[model samples]
Target: MTANTRAPQQERSRATQQRLLEATVECLVEFGWSGASTTVIAERAGVSRGAQLHHYPTRAALVLAAVEHLSERRAAEIRAEAAALTGDPEDRVEQVIDMLAAAFTGPLYVAALEVWVAARTDLDLKAALIPLEARVGREMHRLTVDLLGADETRPGVRESVQATLDLLRGLGVANLLSDDSHRREQLLAAWKRQLTTAIREP
Candidate 1:
């Protein structure tokens, strides 16, 4: 087939995939994992059940693909913000902290939260999630270092950065159940002060 002939077909495929993945996230966020079944997802995406199965094969595959789709979007956003970093070291630190804080409070995180909860007892989902989550964790660690301008060679700097992520994840969990913007802001401010103090002693 000519390139022109294939272009529309490829574009249509991509659009269909995106719609299915988005519907998956919405279902997971709105109805939990069991509710986000392949049939419902296909219905929500306005695609046929056969099309959804052709792409995902199973519910676990569908959910994981949706997670991967969300991950790429976030990674792109973080890289853009990292590139735009400016100001004094303290400013960079605070800005990055706020960026990280914003990451945990959104719809994407809520969708991910449901997936994690459902994965607890679902062996197939757990198997897929473990490897994908590992890959994402590594990428996030890299982004954290990039955002922090941290000398990973320096003692404890890497661990401190990891601690920042750990703390944020905890706060993200807390925010799921409570209005934690005020608490998160307070903790983020304290973390920034502590990070500044720790990294300034070069």
Candidate 2:
């Protein structure tokens, strides 16, 4: 096979891989991570099981790819939202928190929670998820620094960002598990109050 002849085949393969990855995310959201099967994902993507296997020979491989894809897409959306904010640092921070809260109530959020639960018992899942978690932390820190005009290099600023990220993660967990909107609102309000205080303090 000549190099020129192989280029088109490579592109088609990449496209198929992307479709499979997208289908995996959709399947994970529609069916819980534990419930999503290779056959189901293949059907969802309108591909044969053989084609799916060509892209991802193992379930873990598919799950890892899906997580990576989801993380990248979510990070892009969040950074775009942050960039579009036109207000005070505090307002931007609130907007970011609100976006995060909304995400926690969505299907992707449920998939993420499932991943976290599985990660507790599965070493491979844990290994795959750790980088995504760290990327989230790094993005949060970058957002805090950009919006608040805080010097990330400073010890105190780093500590503050870490605390804020911890609070956000905790809030996400609460929002995911709770079904009561009023309760979620109350908790979110409290969190906002705390954030407001932190941002406004001299």
Candidate 3:
């Protein structure tokens, strides 16, 4: 086959791969990891089963790709939001906290929980989550250091920021399990108060 003839075929293959990845995410969100079969994903992508298999031969490979895709998109959004803050260090920190809180309480949070649940039973899923979780932690720590002007290398800085992140993550999970917005707001307010007090301390 000529290179010129292969170009269109390559472009079409790339498009099909992208569509399959997108469909995998949608199926995961709608049906959870266990229910997201290759057949269902192919159907959702409007591609043939053979095409889906050609791109992602194994379920683990497909799920890993989808998870990586989601993680990258979320990280970009978080970094962009953090970069957009314009204010003093304290204000920037507050903005970062608020942005993280929103992320934890929204669709991303729900999707994360779904992935976590799947990870418990699927070794590939669990393996995929490790680096993504580390990246998120590193990014959060970087944002905290930038906003607070803290030396991230300092003994206490990592602990303090990680504590705050842990609290927010827990709040997100709690909020997801319950339908009470008032309780969620109360929890967030309490966290804000704690953050303010921490910032005032030597």
lDDT of 3: 0.75
Say which candidate scores most in TM-score.
Answer: 1
Tens digits of per-residue lDDT, candidate 1, 70-148, equal 8788788877877888868889989988888788777777888788888989998998899999998888888988787
Comparing candidate 2 with candidate 3, which one achieves the higher TM-score?
2
Q: What is the lDDT of residue 44 in candidate 2?
A: 88
Q: How close is every model to the real structure, measured as TM-score?
A: 0.93, 0.81, 0.80
Worst 10 residues of 1 by lDDT: 193-202
Runs in model 3 lying further than 4 Å from the true structure: 1-11, 127-136, 143-149, 196-202
Query: Per-residue lDDT for 153 in model 1?
Result: 86
Q: Tens-digit lDDT track for model 2 on 117-172?
A: 77888898788778877776586577656655556554455676677667656666
lDDT of each: 0.86, 0.73, 0.75
Sort order, TM-score high to low? 1, 2, 3
lDDT of 3 at 28: 78
Give me the candidate number with maximum lDDT.
Answer: 1
Candidates sorted on lDDT, descending? 1, 3, 2
| Residue 103 of model 3, lDDT score | 74
Clash pairs of candidate 1?
A: none
